[model samples]
Target: MFLASSAKPIDDNLKNFVDEIEAQSPSLSVLAARQFRYSLRQTPVELNIKEPRQFNVLEEFIIRAAIEFQPPPTEDELASVLGLDSVFIKTTTATLRSLQTLSATSPITVTPEGRSFYEKGSVPQPPYPIQINAITDPLSDKITFQSESLNETMINLPDLADFITIDKTIADIASLPLEEIQKSIQASGLALHIPEEGKIVASCKVVASTQKIWRKISLFVIFDALEDKLSIQIRNGKQILESASNWLEVLHSESRISLQALCKLSTEAINFEREAILKQKNTEIEARIEKIRKEALETSTKANNEIDKSKVLGEAVQLRNGQISLAFSEVLNSAKSQILIYSPWVNQAVVNEKFITLLQKLANRGVWILFGHGIARRQEDEDKPVPPEVEKKIRAIKTPDGLPSVQFFWLGDSHVKEVIVDKEIYLCGSHNWLSYRGDYLPRGESVYKVTIPHQVQEAYEFLANRFQNHAQKLWENALENRDFQMAVESLCVRGALGMEDIALKEIQNNNWLELLPVWLNVALQGLKSKNLPGDSESFKTALSLLSQVSIEETFIEQLQQGWRKVIGAIAINNPETALNLLSDEVWAQFIRLKIVQESDSPNDFILYRI
Candidate 1:
């Protein structure tokens, strides 16, 4: 489950071996040595010294050992592994010894006549003489390993095109042209190594060549993008591109001289194959989904524009040129069993005429009808009169028992306008369908209707939902009005009867202390007396005259009681005058009673405080 259980131990051991190697010399790994050679190549040409791989036997052993086993190597194992055929080793040693001696002997020399030659009797080319050296100089000794020997001894493998097929990984790959261009090498056969079978799988072509300075550099190249054949590399910025019209041009003129280039091309090919398959699949899926979404949206728009009776009221009614119109009376007249109306508006006169007529007609046909009517007005019209003419017309409609079959019921009136008929026809809009607000309107108003399937449970659900939405709005408005009334009455009662501190606290919290109108209104209730030093007696006179002008005997009695307290409280310092002004009931409250301690019996009861 965890990599540390096995992988960590192997890595730790590997690190220990690498650390020991590093302590001696950091340039112990083949990759580091190769990089060293690369760095040396990048140096300015003036300091160009031949590479020195052959000079140190241990260095040669570490490099080959690193390439084979990588780490945790034993000394004997590495040496045995690196020690190739002695014949080859001896030949390389001899060449190195000769070059070392030539470099030490002179600054410049041409031939045996001018300088001693190992060949002893041979003629030499001019530049060749300047280039030739004994195998003794450390720098020249490094050269023979890279020169004639490496090139001459390296074996060239035959192309195995006949035995190749596309790798199993890309059998599903159709044609991705860009991938073909990008996938030059992987899209087709490059090469593979099958060491167990003692074969290479035609993925790479290896070749050897000697440089002008007699150093050797191997080049590996892969053919990529058959339509636009390119030389691809795995670990380099450099490449050689050539167009091959056919396979013959590749076999003949396409120079496949470097084994390294083949590795680079194979890497690029593998990466391209994987990425292309995934990208293609994603592109196809996204294209299909986008096509579906676009088609669905187009279908929805078409449906929303459709017109006909099969659609509730049809899309024609939804047009926004600016009027919502409906005519659902036809639907009501056709009802078979029952009619139910759920209009939020219960306008008095209109309900008396059209609504009552509809309900009475439906009831006469033995169809049950339920109508809700009490959407309250701004203030209570609980005792308000109905026009006699509308009332007479409504009375004309009756059931078999000769009683009014149409009834109105409502919870409250806030802001709702709706209509339902026979549970099969429904209408709701900004305007009441009856002559309701229409009676007071200056011009045109808006209305709309929705026909219900009498059989659908959503009919009752639809009305119940409308009631719930408006009920919340009504409840919120009621709470706002209640809070305002409480705040106003709270200041009136408390400021009139409370201590100064309590009144001031209420004033401060009311946030209207700075508004002179509110302060005066709140303070006026606390005046206690009407006639002060500057009194014109206007308010007192108005109260005195109004008290006698009673609209109702009960109201007059309440006013009389209020006036008695108002005058008596002003004469508080004159108890005789207050007593004379008080009525019998008022005198009963002021004729104080004493508080007697319960600790004493009737014989010794004491009046302590009153």
Candidate 2:
């Protein structure tokens, strides 16, 4: 759009380009690579012409003198009257006569055309023809002229074509500003003798135009990951465009599919690299483990001691790559109440069939799993895509109640690699437990594993707060995208972090009353888990949201029943607020009839005669 000429054919050197990128920055790597066509519009227009004045100063003076003289002086007399040489005056008059500005005979007289020309600013030249083709760059919304239209072969992918459809309206010549038209004309290499200060566009008009022609431009999306940081960038054939302000705005406005494809590409690339690296290093790692076992066995035999079969260490210990892997596996398997993980990336390589099976088992045991991944430190780095395959598999794991046990949320900005299991163990380090496979090249990666309860609890709270802080942003984005399931997941995270009021505020502000059934279910779960207080602000807001649910609104019988039960539960917590909100008749029916009352346990409520 900035008029950098058309892009050449995209090169097939993507792999080499990625290799070069990784070489320059060992921590940065490309995940996926694809080339797609963006659109540009070309419009043909006719420009009306305005020529510069053709007469010289002497010539104009002589012509004016002849027109002023009452008798219309002869060429010789005109020369004398204007105080100019007769030879020069005669020659100038001959040229003017040829141009029909003066009579061809001996008299130097202003013709009808010459009189009009003199009165209208004394111009000597007639209008000439000017027309050109202008093209609009969709990205920058700038119009420019090209000698010929872009000739790139068009692709036929309907989805991509639809994605690249130009939404900005292109202004026609009539609608275009005069200065802009002139600028495009000048850029097209039109020869105009008139100074720019002169009215160049006053004589111009859009005589004709062709239909808008759209052409393709090559574009690239790149992902960078280094030092636990992650970012996505866009590039053209020339260079990275994310650095350009205009292109940055375009990237921000690009469709979610376009951006998701970029993230998918980067993840694919990383997965490919991870596979190759592990394939080469597995043998060496196995051999090293075998050697360590042999040494331990030999030392134990000499001391006549039994080697401990349980590898679970109850004290703080530093773990390298192999130890980190074993520890991650053990933590996932041994977790009884919860599992908290913070990694900037996730890949199928780590979450394979075995991992999926373990997650299912953990879900069955009701171990709450929270996985927060993102290291986008800047504003531009937010809204990254979670790998589709990874997300699908994780979300597939459900608890006995048919609800997801794992909650995945974007941290937006976090570099800490940690895994806390059941407040009994904490792991933190440089190693990416959910993403990285040890390199083929020997590199040291370590994480400190601590069993100290206070230390583990502290780490858990830190990671949980990260998810809560970013949950609101994710919730808003999900609602905007109409991703209801993700929206629910985001709110669940807030509930888990004891920020139910924030979640309720989102529901109230976003007009999410329809989701109240699910929200109340989450609230019930929180109460059961002993996380939410009976008289918390969350209960107060719940009563307010319930007041807004229209009585005339239609709902499924089951949902309506669930809604009543949750309302009764809320009354059990905030009885005065519920009485003040609900109709007195409704309260009497619920209380006087014993329809909703405390069961054997005070906190537990049952619906008796619904």
Candidate 3:
């Protein structure tokens, strides 16, 4: 059930890609993304190898003949009895005499070594500690030496619904023809040396136990808006394989066609997720609203004169609707450093001429205001523009330094309502500051006011963080966010993927010393594409920067190959410049490329390199 299954092992890169797609109304929408486990049948197999024992076949045969004979046959008699090859018999006897296996006399006689070898029945047999390469593909029936031996511990059974129906049966690896297996093993690129004759598959036993394991694949269902067609891309391990070719080959036709049904299921899943998220949010909002209403009722029933003024800064005080407006005015007049507010909506009823005058006075006094307002349940309402006059009035406020004092933000579909003054006083409740007309009958609107230092600061920070998070989401370019390191890493990836303009622009403008790694990455990718120009300076720059980082040997080798490629290209024209660019340290390792000057043409050189 991994097909439309909700469980997907998402890496950070894929998560960011999905988030970006969700952030905008891009033409391409991801319909489905999940891991599809592929079951690989691991059947145990036994393989054998032919190895040299203490003696070879011919030597053992001669010794056995001499020992078994009634009179212990002479060399002439033995050769005549065997096949009448006297010269061959003499040569073999000479070798045996050297090994102390036969006497140096005319007739062959068993020496001590020969007697013990016959008595012990020591003869050519399949070599023990067999060098077996047991890796095989059940589908293709191709054996490989690259894989480790399969064991019982790696077995896993798949649910009927989870795995694709494989058309092929488990291949009998043990029953395969020796020649075919030999060919397959050779193709695996292992440096296995095979004898010219008698390269035997001494024994092969197909073990009864078989293992089944699953491979996790990341499946992304894509919709082409222009074509009005649905297609799929799958990440099997590290590779995002080309469509249809690897898919049909691995999963078969039935599983390939079943992907079309995912569009409906994925749509329903997204809707379900949205509704669930909204339900959780509404529950929290309702709880906060109810708490405010309950507090308002309690406060309204009590006499305002009875509440001690000295206790206000030490604890929370519930305020009635009228007191809420009075507290807001007090915050505006008494604020010293900063003011932060969150209201669900903005209207002329509250943000009137008097409110503007109070806000302006605070700005003149050097107090900064951060204001956010927006709330909606529907898409159309969320998209509705803010009141133009409200925005203009808020925008007019200026700080003592002549910079804009008011930082205005529109919180999308938010339900939070609070105000924090100088990180000292906080007011949070169900009352809307700007939208409430204050003419309605007793509606139990309440505001919770607190002046505890920690509580006020915590509330202020929470609201501030929310605004920053929202701003990041609203940012048009992801790379422009505050995280410079992440932005640089992303730029490097993009540059490596052939978006050279971005890297080039950054390089031309910024300090190259800090971006050497980025330059190296781009050069490496360019080398892979085989599209780098002979005169390009990127490769040379990357090579010069290699001493700065501790790179892997494999990476250094690849970089060296790239350097040779660039040098070869450059040597075709301006050979002297290419020669000058080559460092002695790298040149020693890359001596395969030799440039020789032509006698006839003084300035001309011929180059040969790999």
Candidate 4:
């Protein structure tokens, strides 16, 4: 969600803007003034063609210099402008000549006099008539902007309407068989979408030969603008059974034309999911009923199994009081000569640190332990990305299989809690993994992921459906190749559709937004992804439900209280929500942030919907 603001770099006006920020919030003044002085030049760099780390250092030095220094046109300014300390400047300077390339035309190069003045600690005043044009497109991997011109317009990606026409043409095209489409597109492809009136802007293809198993070629159809809904001619693997409108069928008034088919697809997906959640709930209730019945039946029979039945009945009574661990131990102990562990989040923490040693010792004494957990992601970062600090010394362990192990797994929708040992050893209550959460540093205490064997089975089911047993790649924008992020986008935009419809239509084709004229703020924009988990989508749903005024306010509020919180940035562009961020006189910080440069700016950044 990078915004590109147009420039209104009037010298006196710019001076006044700087003066005001500094005067009102002098500290912010130093920080905010970078928008006025520094020029941002970004270009994509593929790994193959590279000049090593020269431009990397230069760019780092500039942003670092800009952010760190006060009244920063000095050596400190250079450091702040780049993202490093001054000690590296000499090496950076030596590398600059070998590094700098003017794909366009060379501007004035920095001379020794300029370097000496900066080296002598005098602020180098920026030359007047600052050249503030943004590098809208990258000529190559590395981009360098002149320090003088700091204000210019940045172009944005196109919308849905621009590239596709689905009403007639798309329907006709998607109707093709797999083989011909593969030959034409030069791959095996799935044509999943068609906009009602626009072009067939987006499509996905499967690489025919040597395509990795389960590997898919995702063709993201980015539209020029938001249309009401696409009218599509539908097909289900073989026959032209129906003509479904590829439209936004306002379920409760969102958008889209084809509601019935969409609903059908979505309902099926949701049914599969809901069955898993509800199954345990229903089974537990039935199991309780069955236990009482069995006890009555045993007493009625008065057979030799009477004592065993009474013991089982006695055990069942303890369930209401929650003696899960006792029950689990009983189950394990009662196992004549066989035992198996079915946990998704089993590590030292769940059973003690001596748990493994104990298990291995037990195994040597003839106990079979069947332990299971998903493989850990293989990462190669020498200096691991630091996790936020907590008082607890959390360290991951290497398993015998050469995988990092942790006692954390999702309960539902990628939750971070656990169900342990069995339905018996339950350890769940108010516990949170957060250390420096919000203003309350190390605030949250233990908010446990409830532990029960049934719950564990439920957790395993959810994980299997979602994670695909593979680690997600680390893409730059997160939006780049982010199939998961695309899911998030759908959850936000499409509201509460059945999981089936959500995946089939919303995610499979349209949700992935493309950045048009990609050179603009690739790095800064890429910084937006956070591993903030939980359903911010549910929040959106709650808000929509509130807008409908369908239920009592108190009821909604109560639901929210129990609702789980997730760590994801609120979709910055929810029309109802985002419209608030766009009222008159909201441009102050944007100006300071270089997001909006001119006061007379009629909003340089425009979001297109298709």
| Candidate 1 local lDDT, 465-569, one digit each (tens) | 333333333334534665543343333323222222343344344433222122233323233222121132322232223322323333343333444333434
- Who wins the TM-score comparison? 2
Give the least accurate 10-residue stretch of model 4, judged by summed lDDT.
216-225
Clashes of each: 35, 5, 3, 69
Query: Candidate 2 lDDT, tens digit per residue, 1-610?
Result: 1111112122354555555655654234444444545555566555555443656788778778787777778877766766778888878787788656787786677787676666655555545555566777655556776545555454652333454444556676568777777777677675552444232433446444544444433343333322233344445544664433344345445633353443233344445444443232224323433443354345445432232422332335566766778878887899766678888778777777888899888877656688878767543575645678888999888765456777875654555577877667787777877777633333588667766455556566656655665566578788889787877787777765666777878888888776666677666655544456556666556655554556555533334555465556556666554444445444433343243442322223322211
lDDT of 1 at 409: 32
Q: Give me the runs in candidate 3 sitting further than 4 Å from their true place.
A: 1-35, 38-215, 218-273, 288-313, 364-366, 377-379, 382-384, 438-444, 452-462, 474-610
Stretch of 10 with least lDDT, candidate 3: 593-602
Model 3 C-alpha lDDT per residue in residues 77-103, reported as the tens digit of each score: 878877868888788878777545577
How displaced is residue 467 in candidate 2, in Å? Answer: 2.0
Please give the lDDT score at residue 421 for candidate 1.
49
The parts of candidate 4 lying over 4 Å away from their true place are 1-234, 238-254, 258-305, 308-398, 404-407, 413-610
* Tens-place lDDT digits, model 4, residues 470-518: 1111122244656443333233211111122232232224323221101
What is the TM-score (0 to 1) of candidate 3?
Answer: 0.39
Q: TM-score of predicted model 4?
A: 0.23
Superior candidate under lDDT, 3 versus 4? 3
- Stretches off by above 4 angstroms in model 2 are 1-315, 320-326, 333-338, 364-366, 374-387, 399-402, 409-416, 422-424, 436-445, 451-458, 478-483, 533-537, 551-558, 561-610
Relative to the true structure, how large is the alpha-carbon lDDT of every model? 0.33, 0.59, 0.55, 0.28
Task: Tell me the deviation in Å of residue 306 in model 1.
Answer: 5.5
Best by lDDT: 2
